[model samples]
Target: MIFVRLCLNTIVRRWNSTELTKVQMPAIMHLTRLGYTYAVKFHDNQAGEDYVPDTNILIKIFKEQFERLNPDKKDTFNQVLKDIKMELDNDDLGRSFYNRLVSVSPSRLIDFEHPNNNVFHCTAEFTCKRDEDEFRPDITLFVNGLPLTFIEVKKPNNNGGMLAESNRMNNQRFPNKKFRRFINITQLMIFSNNMEYDSEGGIIPIQGVFYCTGSKSKSSFNCFREENKGGEKVAPYNAEYSYKSIDSLVEKRVLTDFNC
Candidate 1:
């Protein structure tokens, strides 16, 4: 009787073990496939043909632009920028962004991965199968294990080009349910025309986009939330604001919030 009981216990343990393996093995395999692609594209000795833009270059531009701005305009500009940034940093955005990039929690990911995991040597672009179609984002932001953000950048002089790109990005067909299932884990969707900044559903045109410059002045940042038609809110479609304000929003972890 004791032997029979022991055998039953062993079977139960094995069943539980199998269940756990079933859940974790697929993710491990999927991540491994992603890793393989990452390794091939980012080999150390690649030359000019393999180069990608340095994100730090963009950051440097923001810093330099801010420094170059006139001092009298800095205060108001800084305040508005700071407020918008704080709004973006709220918990919802941060968690969604972190989850999308890290695969696991950001803290644990950092603990297990190398410090430079999030920094890629080059931009790795690929087309993955989405439903029955193929879809690709212009750039994928990677850390060590997973993609953090999908960025679509447009040249500053590309008249109406940015808008076109934005439309493509927000298209449901691009991030089909399957792709969304894979990338929904990501944090933010960034659309920049090298001139304007915008995000999902805050205000349109006026409130939706901002001009990003580094100048320090109230004029550097403008809100499109003002009333235009007899106290009715006017939506400024493509007005520009300082890029500094946009950078502050990103740096301060404003886009971290997922809540609308």
Candidate 2:
């Protein structure tokens, strides 16, 4: 957890972003009309009142992208979300979702990259619920009010392995489950520890083939093995995997439509 925090803080200090600690998911769900306006229909626990927005800002972005992805079809936020969910529901076409996500134009990132852009928000130990059950990831990243990446941190040595733990979190733990509505909208999935790291979703695989939903661990996961395959030393897909701390890796670049 410390290592991940170090990386996050490094990026936060270097880039035009803000990191919030001791924040609840409800607070993060609603945007205060600063850098980005998500306008999500968040259940307001603040002031013990109810607040519902008419449109989801992130979903609106998706709707625009979907319209661009299919110019012939008329797009609505609900239909756009349902279409992505349909592709997401299919195990074989998981990478299609990643392709579409990355294909989103940089303009849609929403006033990012400026000195006061403030589109990216990072929080530690945020609680999210799937129906009545709740889980807290080590870190949750929000881009323009969209909770895009979820990071699960662990100790050096735990259960089966980092891969096993990541698989459990990615596929079993409220994720890919109907009740966990939040996970359905999430694009990037990551798991890390001091000794090992793995990331999936959001970005396409270097090998050019993404993992099937049913085959989560097979081709999708990229680990920092650095082993020699066929007498050639293999490197992690993204150089950031090898980097202890870098501004462009997970934070600045992933949020933008740079196609890294």
Candidate 3:
């Protein structure tokens, strides 16, 4: 009887360690707590090569924010978006996009001064297509409707953990020209397996969360660490963030038995 119980517990533990359960859902939940509005779509198909901006959402948010920021400019929303899209198409590694994000262009894309004036959106399974290629990120974070960052989550204690994921992105994903627009628009990429760095390694990430500004270099992977001035470590969970329905949602969606 005890052996059967232990086996059941082991199965549950393994089941709970899935990428979606261990990291993706929790990340989305945390983002929602951090003031990001959850963006949901019934289908995974987001149209266009530069679906990073999800043109529809971009237009909606841009019009509202742009008109508010540049109140003197009348009916120039379309022109501004067109110019921004042109800049994005001609830019490299999202450099132009980043500029528009931080500073005011001929037109304003995001209100960096009043952060609350900008829209923060978070979504998962963000699928974007470019000709014959389709890249679906595990989680995509949007600022003012532009997908500036995305996260890739892996099952904990997987084959190579963080290193394997980094290699896959740099070797398989980045080199594909079909992903050129996607890569150009995305400013940051984060990877995690819900574990700490416990392996002996020089610079290669073996575990824990790491982020890089696009895949400019394979060696750009850097671990994320937060410490206060007092030398005490700070953690995300240490913050008091909660939602009334989050517990129930996690139980129903994250922890629920797929077999059942």
Best by TM-score: 3
For each candidate, what is the lDDT?
Answer: 0.36, 0.43, 0.68
Q: Model 3, 29-77: lDDT tens per residue?
A: 7776677767664253444322333322344555666788778874887
Off by over 4 Å in 3: 1-17, 42-57, 201-203, 216-219, 229-260
Per-candidate clash tally? 30, 0, 0
Q: Please report, as a residue range, the 10-residue window in candidate 2 with the lowest summed lDDT.
A: 47-56
TM-score of each: 0.34, 0.41, 0.77
lDDT of 1 by residue, 1-260 (tens): 99999999888766534432332222223333343122223322432233212111122222223333323444443453343234333434244434423443212322234443333311323343433655554455444333445554444444554445444444553334444333333444554444333533545442232322111111122323443445333334313322122233332221122111
TM-score of 3: 0.77
Candidate 2 lDDT, tens digit per residue, 1-260?
A: 99999999788654322223222222233222123332322332521122112111244434444454445554344554555556555454256555545553422233323435334555545455534566665556666445666665544344544556545655666443432344544666665444423233534222221112223333245543444445443343433243332333333323332111
**Which RMSD values do the candidates have, in order?**
22.3, 12.8, 5.7
List clashing residue pairs in candidate 2: none
Backbone clashes in model 3, listed as residue pairs: none
Judge candidate 2 at residue 189 and give its lDDT.
60
lDDT of 2 at 239: 30
Select the stronger candidate by TM-score from 1 and 3: 3
